[model samples]
Target: MLLASYKAIRPGMQGIANRLIRWRLDGDYSHNEVVFEPGDGVDHLMPDGTCEPDASGALWCASSVAWERLPATSPRRPGHRGGVRFKRIKLDPAHWDLVKYRRDPLAAAQHFKRREGALYDWQLILGFVAWLFRHKASRDTCSEVCTEAGGQLEGHRVDPCTLHQIVAAEDRHFRSLLWLAAAGEEAAY
Candidate 1:
C-alpha cells in the first residue's frame, strides 16, 4: 500500500530545523515522506521478504533527506551521500498524518524507488526560505519527491503543510488512512 506521511516538529535538537520551516512557512507539518508496505512491489527493500510495522505502528518510508544518517534501501549513487533513501521510521500517531493513495500503490512505489540516492535539493529548500537564494537543479527535496511520486500537486514546489492541505481537501485521490483517521473525523495533523 502507498501512504503520504507528514511529520510535525519534535522536541530538542531534532526539531530545530522543523521548527524553523514551520515558522517560515506557517505550516503545522515540517516534513513529508512516502510510506511503503511489503508485497507492494517493494519487496527488495523489506527484510526477509516481509515488512513489519514497529510498536507504534510505523513502517518503511522513502524520502529525500538532508543531514540524516539513515541507510538507503537502494542507493542510486553509492558514493554520494544525503539524498533519497528508504528508512524504517517509528511515527507517533499523534505527530504524524497519513494519507492513503487510492490508485496503484506499486506504480508510485516504483517511481519513488528510482529516485533513491538522488542528491538533496538544498538550493530549493533555501529558496523556500529566501526567494533570492532559490536555485533549481538535479536534486530532490522531501516534499517535491513525494508529491511527484504520488502524482499529487505535480510540477509544484510544495512544502509539508501545503501537501497535507491538498490531500486533506481532495478526497477522490487521497484519504486519511484508517489506522490514523478517527471514526468519521478529520485527521488532526
Candidate 2:
C-alpha cells in the first residue's frame, strides 16, 4: 500500500512531516507497507482482543511507522513511540493506492514477521529532509521494509513514491488494484 500526502494538512493526515516528506522526496506518497494478509478468507484478531470477522475483510499490513496512534498489536521500542508495526486496515482508495506484487508470500511474511520490533530509521528519513548525514540504518523505514520484503536489494535508497514507479515499470512483478474512475463514476462501466 502507498499512502499519499498530496495535500497539506488534509483530514486524517498525521502532521506536517508527511508534506515535508513528499517535498523532500519529490513523491506523491510518503508511506508504504506490505500487506501480507489480504483478509479475504481468514478471520483477523483485532487489537482490542476481538476477532474481526473475515466476511468484512481487512488488509493486514506491516511497516515501520511514526504515526500518532500506533495499533495496539504493534511492538513498542523501549523509549520510542514508533517502530515496526502491524495494522489491520481497510483498503480504502481515499488513503491508499493498493499494489499487488507477484512474489513469494510466505518468504516475505516470514521476513517481516521477524522484524516486528525493529526501530524506525529516523536517521535515514532525516537524511532525505536535511540532505546531510547518511547513517548506517540499523533501523528500517516503511519503504525499506516493503521493498526488502519484495526482494528488492536496493530498498535502502528507495522511498514510497519511487517504489510505485519501480513497480509500475515492472509489469510482470506488480499490478495495481486501484480503479481510475471516481468512486461514484464506477457505475458508468
Candidate 3:
C-alpha cells in the first residue's frame, strides 16, 4: 500500500501553493510510503497457529531509512492538516514472486535503513522548481528512497508524483485503497 500526502487548500493566496504543486506535478499526492506488513490487533491468521495480536507485526512502514511501526488502524499521519490516501497494487504473478520470494520490499527497506543518515535533498527540490532533473549522490528524497527500495534505479531525481506516475505506467497493478480528507473523514473516491 502507498500513503500519499495531499491536503485541502483553503481560499485566497494560501491555496495558491497547493494549487501550484498539484498543477505542476499533475497529481494531488506529494509524498509516498510503503506498508510492509499488517499491524497487531487486526484479524489475520498467523504462522504460529495462534489467535492474538501481533505486537511486533503492526503495520510496518519504511520511509527514507526511518522505520515506523504503526497500529493497523492508525491514520496515515495523525493531526496533520494535509490529507492522506492509501493505495494497493495488485502485482502480476511474476512481480509478486519477485517481491515475495526475492523479498524485494524488505531489501528495499533495508537499503534505506543502511543509508539512514542521508540528508534530505533540498537542492533537488530547487531543481524541481527550476524544472531540472539532476541527480545528487549525497542527498535523497522520499520518493527516491522508496523507488530505490523497490529495486528501481531510475529514481535518482524523481519527485513523489513523478515516481508514482512512472511506477503506475510501467506496472498496471496500482489500485486505490482509501482516501481521507484533512479532517480525518474517509471517502470512497
Residues 1-189, model 1: lDDT tens digits: 545555666678658988888888887788887777655666664533445676676688878888775463455665456787777777667777876545466666676667777788888888876788764556788888878877754433788788767766665433445534565466443
List, residue by residue over 8-110, the lDDT tens digit for candidate 2. 3344556577777787877778788766543322222223333242455765666778643455555555345677776665656776666555566655665
Predicted structure with the largest TM-score when compared to the true one: 1
lDDT of 3 by residue, 5-102 (tens): 33356366546755776677787555555544432221232223232324543333444421222223323342222222222223233222211112
Return the top candidate by lDDT. 1
Q: Candidate 2 lDDT (Cα, whole model)?
A: 0.63
Q: Candidate 3 — number of clashing residue pairs?
A: 3
Q: Is candidate 1 or candidate 2 better by lDDT?
A: 1
Candidate 1 residue 179 C-alpha distance from true site, Å: 19
> TM-score per candidate, in order?
0.76, 0.71, 0.50
